[model samples]
Target chain A: MNNEMKLSFSSYSSNESFARATVAAFVAQLDPTIEELSDLKTAVSEAVTNCIVHAYRDAIGMVYITASISKDRRITVKIRDKGCGIPDIAKAMEPLFSTGGEERAGLGFSVMESFTDSLRVRSKVGQGTTIIMHKKLAGRLSGFAR
Target chain B: MGVRFVLKDDHLTAILSGEIDHHAASGMREEIDRKAGQAKPKLLTLDFSQVTFMDSSGIGLIMGRYRLMQALRGSLTVLDLSQQMKRVVNLSGVGQLVPLENSRPPRKPKASAKSKPKETIPETVEQEPPQPEEESRDIYSHSEWENQEKKEVMVHE
Candidate 1:
């Protein structure tokens, strides 16, 4: 089964939940386990948060998210923002590195990496940042299968 | 998200409910800190039984509250975390800093029973020595991070 979805919303903190929920609902068709679903939701939340907090900073921008499920139950989610980009992607991905000041935990990238099977980050100094993550859902035997 | 505080003696428990993402975490952090600071309790308990969902932002919330309690000369304990939430907390190495109390049931205040001691705060606050950050594993290579696929799709509003 193949499915895909795309969403764009303002970079408001309130929309963070919206983004993750939308992705989860779309992925629900694949019949993911509760733990798998939660992991995907957390990865989505972390990526969207980076867009809202780090990418846009104080200015309001738009966050674009695209999610798709492949035939083998592989889920791919792409989150993008056209705001201030990270100069050092490697450092930003570190466990406790945060440029968002004291209130921020700087664990966003680390969480995303750990939750998702694959994580890729691309950014230009002044352009924007894009995070792509992939997670494979376990194939459960259907009760109807002979 | 909402937080309900229950204060008995010098112990304060903040029962957190709803999803704790970045959006809700900031508000919850400010509220918890303000209440904990003003009360200056000897022990601060963060009850996560009511929390339905949490992300890395929850880690920040816990770490910040731990620092606040430390400044106030108090100890912090996390209670009743869901299994999924516990995974995120453990991944951040927060369990090493704050006590993750999930094995036992939460203490309830007795109405008429006086045999049990009223004191809830533990006599000794276990302080684990901070360990050095683990070296970055070769779970994935730097070249893998460089691989990228860009797709442009239009969304109809």
Candidate 2:
């Protein structure tokens, strides 16, 4: 894992897009296709969003995002936030089962799952939550910019 | 985002623009239901060409509208979906419920006789998508961004 490319920010929705854009740029070195890159961005957005809405709940918190290119040219992201952790990981993973008020669909995890091949969540009540996602890039595909 | 409706004869057109996340669902339902009941148009059109982005909550909103129109013996259609928006609708199986049509001026709605019930609060507030802009974006750098097409696993744990 390359440590220099990693970045961190406060957990918020606006910053979710920023994180996505930033990670998409860093992963450009892997020469990902448009669909592949979009997948990465969407996955990252979902994970970061979950942290902001469910974990921090508008409270001030820090979200860490790290992007690394594997030997096989895969892009990996680790999004972590120190906020209210998920009490029931199983229920939280269910589609359409959101714990938010009128303004949340609880589909963040589902969207993340749809866009990426691997998604793992680890959370402890009152501690924090960490989501690790991974995606592989096509070696032959090139010409993307960072 | 709040949606406005312009009723003309038998056609009821909803002009909507904004992010359709969980937060917008309630306002959308109230406005749409109110207009649909008042106009009782034979055709319901949801213009989305102006919408920038939408998520699953948007799907639920459309579904609620579809049910409302079906009760009124009217059909619903969406117009002017961008490529990404279209993909979202398609992926969510919304296309199976209401077909997409090319953009044109609001069509004349066929007159209806049935009166729509007063707007109620049955539809509860749902989930909201992450805001388009938030602070967690500092994770990646602009210099590292690459825009290439590669076929590989998108992500892993």
Candidate 3:
């Protein structure tokens, strides 16, 4: 299960859904259940959204996404943005702590955390931010890598 | 960003589908509010059973509906939620303001979910419903206004 695909797009809010749909299609080769695929799309949506709303706040930048199916049928996604970085990862990951004001529910990280098997974030104040999330598909493998 | 409005007995149910994000949420908030305002239903219900995914923007959409219902002195209830959506709505404290009906087990999806309505409903609900030509006030939130300003400044800078 070494199938991998990556794409980069502008950090516009409109592209959030596009990123989700594209990644879901790329990962469909794993034959994930409907719910599983939906969750993965939702998680990816949150990650890309964070990059657009929080990371690039009030501006536009480049957002890169990479999806890979590992040996254990786990789908891993990494969403990164070259914009403002989060200062506190722990605080940001809280269930209802959003820095985007009333417009934001602040559950971006929590949503990703809930939908995926594991959520990891690495960021620096003046550099950029990246979110890595992985989820194992439920059904048997479709063998896209080999 | 597909929406279908079901106007039942004194209740208006807005069934939202597809991926719900900030861009989609903005359009939904405006259109739903307008329709609900005109209908003035005794109970304004938001049906999320068809919604596959939503983000923080969803919370804002529901919260906006709650505020509009309050202004109208009408009750608001959210119904037919998937487990994932229920988590989002409850976590945002919207549950406290509006009673969320139908927990909706993982399977056995509800018949009322209405993934896509017939030709009776518009595809996107983009057109603003006819109004009495009231004073056009700034409709965007503070953050939205700030975003517009920032976009302009960034372009010039």
Candidate 4:
């Protein structure tokens, strides 16, 4: 569970999917069930998408994703981006609320919240935003540290 | 994105191939509406078999089709979805409207759904035969057009 891999890519919409797939493949060796894998991928996509759409504000930036499976059988993912930080996490997390128009459904945070067991966001205005999500994988936990 | 149509006895199957995003939605809408109307199918199936990728715009496309089918009293089904496509479709709640069916052979292309328009069907005739093309202006044209206009606005911005 201690294995950590990082990737740097432009804050493009297409890259969001790549980030999710990359993280999913990296953690697939942990023997997660098909459903678990799907959930993790969905969660990752949402997080990365948020970084691309909201944090980056249509500007070029790098998104760093780290995945680790803790001894407690918890799979942790942290998506960090050095872009526009969330000034009001509470309002941003509201369902059906989005800064963008109809193109953005504002459901990204809701999807992330529903998919993962534990979700947290740490951000500071004018700095950047970081999202951490955790899911409890069944069976033995990996012996990896974050 | 390319949309191929196959008309069976009473089903008009539209196989959506390639990526379905905002960029490809206008063509997809027109194609699906034309084929569905022409076939006059009792069941419309949107085969996602060859669809390599999809985004929220794809979800919008499916939802639009679902509404059209409902108005026609026809069932809509999806098939041949990648695991990622399945995840996105399921999350969007379209899975509930048109649940995925078991894999089946492609439908016959010659037997179109247009043969028995509801108005012409004989009384007590539930299943009608295939017919020729019946061109009808798409009812969703305005909405689809608005979407395109919005896209243009975004592009110009």
Docking class of 4: incorrect
Candidate 1 lDDT over residue span B1-157, tens digit each: 6899999999999999999998999889888988997899999999998898999889889998988999999999999887789888877777998988864443222211232355465534222222222213123245543431110010000
Candidate 4 lDDT over residue span B68-131, tens digit each: 9998888888776665666566656667878676474323222223333434556544353332
Q: Report the lDDT tens digits of candidate 3 across residue range B1-157.
A: 5788999888898988876887788778878888997899988988888887776678877877888888888988887777667766666677888887875433422332243244355645524233222213224456555555333322211
Better of 1 and 2 by lDDT: 1
Tens digits of per-residue lDDT, candidate 3, A44-102, equal 88888888877888788899999898767888898888888988889988877877767
- Tens-place lDDT digits, model 4, residues A1-146: 26567777888776765777788788766656555777787778778777776788768888888887655567889989899899899999886577855445466676788778989999998889989998987663223332
Against the reference, the lDDT scores of all candidates come to 0.82, 0.69, 0.76, 0.70
On DockQ, the stronger of 1 and 2 is: 1
**Where is model 1 more than 4 Å wrong at Cα?**
A143-146, B103-157
Provide TM-scores for the models.
0.80, 0.62, 0.74, 0.59
iRMSD of all candidate structures: 8.5, 5.4, 12.5, 12.7
Instruction: Assess candidate 3 and give its TM-score to the true structure.
Output: 0.74
DockQ of each: 0.28, 0.11, 0.21, 0.03
User: Best candidate, TM-score-wise?
Assistant: 1
- Candidate 3 scores an iRMS of 12.5
Arrange candidates by DockQ, highest first: which order? 1, 3, 2, 4
**lDDT (tens digit, per residue) of candidate 2 on B1-157:** 5687877889988988875554455678788888889889999999886675565556667777888999999999988765555555555566888988766432211111111134243433212222223223233444433331121222211
Model 2 ranges off by over 4 Å: A1-4, A141-146, B1-44, B50-57, B60-76, B80-87, B90-157
For model 1, how does the per-residue alpha-carbon lDDT over A34-73 read when each residue is reduced to its tens digit? 6788999999999999999988998999999999988778
